[model samples]
Target: MNLSVGITLAAIMTIACYSYLWRENTLYRIAEHLFVGLGAGYSIAMGWNNVKTNAINPLLNDGQYILIVPLLLGALLFTRFLPGSNKWLARIPMAFLVGTGIALSARAAVLAEFVQQIRATIIPLNSVNNILIVVGTIGVLAYFFFSSKFTEGIPGLKYGALVGRYVMMAAFGAAFGNGVMGRISLLISRLQFIFGSWLGLM
Candidate 1:
């Protein structure tokens, strides 16, 4: 529990994790396995502790039988560790998880994605920025419309598609510029750390 000892251990672990950037070596492999082993042990211990507090003590001592179902489901998750006999028991929780996930996603998709996006697109675009958003949305939608072929009979639609292509190119250019700026910023920050913090020469 000593603060200095904990800090030293943390620094060592950080170095060990970063050592993988170099060539493969025994020290890094040992550190990797040690981390995995410790993580697995910690996860198991915490799962057992949660089950004991929420399930076993409540059911046996405090007269709460309601937790048995979830507790049984949680216990079934461990069946994957058993030999070939009862690994199928884990599928119960897996199926439950997939079902719950699908239900949650279906409920969330209506409000967050579909309704909100439609509401946003239908907002008043009286100002310049909102006008730009409206134009961008329309142009992007027009770009994806495949009713009329771009090269075939329609000239006006082709012009609209050409404008949409320009808008897409401009957006992509801005994104690439921002990405380059981000990398430059990171490089500058790392340089500052090396020169200012390490050498006091910045």
Candidate 2:
């Protein structure tokens, strides 16, 4: 069967990776290392390209000196690898990055998870599906209520919390099933590629 070098190499790597499913072997280890090395090299090259085009060019050509602050901070990340007490200097940039990341992520998460989810749940109870959605949402929230013991609280809340627990279990189960289905789909696609494209036996 006719096969291009790229397709042949891809097939070999695919087989090598799948070989781990049976048992770890030298071929799988080689493929894994090759994949990691190529990925890291590509990431480094892309990062440098982005800094040159996006940051360096703007700072030098367009007189955007403020970019230097971020550049300096990024460079400080590597200082952690240096010897002695000087490694503490890296924490300055690390703390700044973590603080900003947390602030940005928390703000976005509040808007998306709290506000958007509440809005979505506040739908008209015009259908059975909408009713179930509203009930399930409330039950899930009640299950997470930790201020007071459920036994000491409102009488009906204990039952509501129980229902909420069930709802959460169902949600988790569905998520897990979906994940397994996705993995199976990937396996099917790989099998099709090996048999239909490479071997021409499908």
Candidate 3:
């Protein structure tokens, strides 16, 4: 393989991506369309290759007859192209796909997201970091306790709500600062590349 050719293609692709910063025009539109088309074409080609290797060639030579089921289901998915007579045929494959996807997501949700998040929240608050996290969590939770009406007579409840509100406000401010910092860092990196690498000033 030619490394120089690969590098040239990568550089061209990078420039195409960055051209959007100027404005949306024919060049940017063409690049966007090319990206989508290339992605779809590559996906179809890979899927076809997988089916041929795993199903078609094997079934033709020595694989089990059960492999025909998936091929039939795949064919059913294309039935959506037919208007009247064969559209219902697509439902078999569609149903199978939805069923499989839901099953996978259900399995992953409990283990990966739900359980892990709960575990992360249940740590001890002995250290300074843990203590800060615990305090923040309590303050935020207190803010949502609707029983604490902001009345003059109930002093403790009012204070709790105030603490929660301030904590939430601080959290939001910190999040915004972090986001702005990230954008500034990206701008700095791009400038570094243009000035130091491209222009060789550094």
Candidate 4:
């Protein structure tokens, strides 16, 4: 319960993983495999836990007979392990899973990535920031759609697109810098854990 052994094991694993920075070796390979195996095992455990808590417990204790339909669909997933034509039964659950996932994901993505973006850009251009946002959004769109030869003889479109290219480059650069900062922050925290907690070097 005190987790002393867990801390020691994590320290050793961390060193083994970071050893790959110098060169690959047995220690790094072992650490990699251990991490992956633990992740897979944890995922399987969580999957069963979810199924039991949400489906089985309800069906058995609460007498929720309606849960049987989804339970049957879930059970069909294991038919792939059986022999002969029964393997095709797994496809039904797989198709349902894939179709449902895509539908939900696409709906969320349209709201987050498309609708929200357009809504965010619709602010009044009374301020400099708002003006820049409106101009930048239009420029970026023009850069993509107006670069074709059909856009010839269109005055100012080319200039707007050129501005858009720079705007896109700046956006990408900022995103990349943010990602790098996140990685660097993780490294710093890991180092702090190693030196401060593991070595008591504070």
RMSD of each: 5.3, 2.2, 5.2, 3.2
| Model 1 bad stretches (over 4 Å) | 1-3, 79-88, 138-202
Which candidate, 2 or 3, has the higher lDDT?
A: 2
What lDDT tens digits, residue by residue, belong to model 2 across residues 68-158? Answer: 9999998999999998889988999999999999999998999898899889999999999999899998888888888778998666778
TM-score top scorer: 2
Tell me each candidate's TM-score: 0.62, 0.87, 0.64, 0.83
lDDT of 3 by residue, 1-202 (tens): 2235654454455567678889777767877888999999999999999999999988999967889999999998999998888799999999999999999999999989889866787878789988767666766776677764667545666666777788888989999999999989976876565555555666
Q: Which pairs of residues clash in candidate 3, taking residues 3 or more apart in a chain or in different chains?
A: none
After TM-score superposition, the amount by which residue 57's alpha carbon in candidate 1 deviates from its true location, in angstroms, is 2.2
Tens digit of per-residue lDDT, candidate 4, span 1-202: 2248877788889999989999999999999999999999999999999999999999999999999999999999999999888899999999999999999999899989989989999999799999999999899888877446425766778888888999999999999999999999988998888887877777
Candidates in order have lDDT scores of 0.80, 0.92, 0.79, 0.90
Off by over 4 Å in 4: 1-3, 80-88, 98-115, 146-155
How many backbone collisions does model 1 have?
Answer: 0
Give the TM-score (vs. native) of candidate 4.
0.83
193 Cα displacement, candidate 4 (Å): 0.9
